[model samples]
Target: MHVDLTRDSVAMGDDVDAPHRQSLHLTDDASLGDAVSAVLARPYLAQIGGGKATWLVVVDGTVSAVVAQQWAGPRWLADARVRAPGAIHFRYLAQRDPGEVYVEYSRCQGQP
Candidate 1:
């Protein structure tokens, strides 16, 4: 299943077919943390996208390397908080890498 979270809502899906995917509309009014928790409520496999995230290892990508990297986690979310009314994007990685995950949030440009 795929899970997504925004500043105000959470969505989930179980398949590649967009029309047949599933989601849980948690709320329209929420904090970033709340949205994340709501997303965690669902079940999934892994991640691919990292927004100011840290990973010990990455594979199959062009930049496949064993390296340690970290970013301003809270500050990025803080930026998102300031840019409210944003959208959450969630997707599944390849079936071979079910242990991967991808989660991201971004406010529409010029929407202050």
Candidate 2:
């Protein structure tokens, strides 16, 4: 199932005072291929679309990568450690190769 970006909201926690967060939503039904593409598309998700958004990748309840948008992209590789802020981390689990991610936007200066 594809994650309903329209129905979902990205936040730090369930607290009303939690730091407001932006998210790059991917459908739960989205295939692994698509998820990988989305990440790569927005190498700097926080800077591009997801404002303070966390890349929440999960498969079978096992969390995959929890990377910050600013530090995520197509460069992620298996066993690779692409770092960003202390709060972000990317994990490449699916089978894929480099130069596989692509993203475009008319404006990238605001939150998505």
Q: TM-score each candidate.
A: 0.30, 0.29
lDDT of each: 0.28, 0.33
Candidate 1: which pairs clash? 12-22, 46-99, 46-100, 46-101, 47-100, 47-101, 47-102, 48-101
What RMSD, rounded to one decimal, does every model reach?
12.0, 13.8
Q: 12-112 in candidate 1: lDDT tens per residue?
A: 53233343233445455554444434544554223334522222111112111111113222223132232112334332222322112212222321112
Q: Model 1: which ten-residue window has the lowest total lDDT? A: 59-68
Indicate which candidate wins on lDDT: 2
Candidate 1's TM-score: 0.30
Q: What is the lDDT of residue 105 in candidate 1?
A: 21
| Candidate 1 steric clashes | 8
Give the runs in model 1 whose Cα sits over 4 Å from its true position.
Answer: 1-20, 44-76, 79-86, 91-112
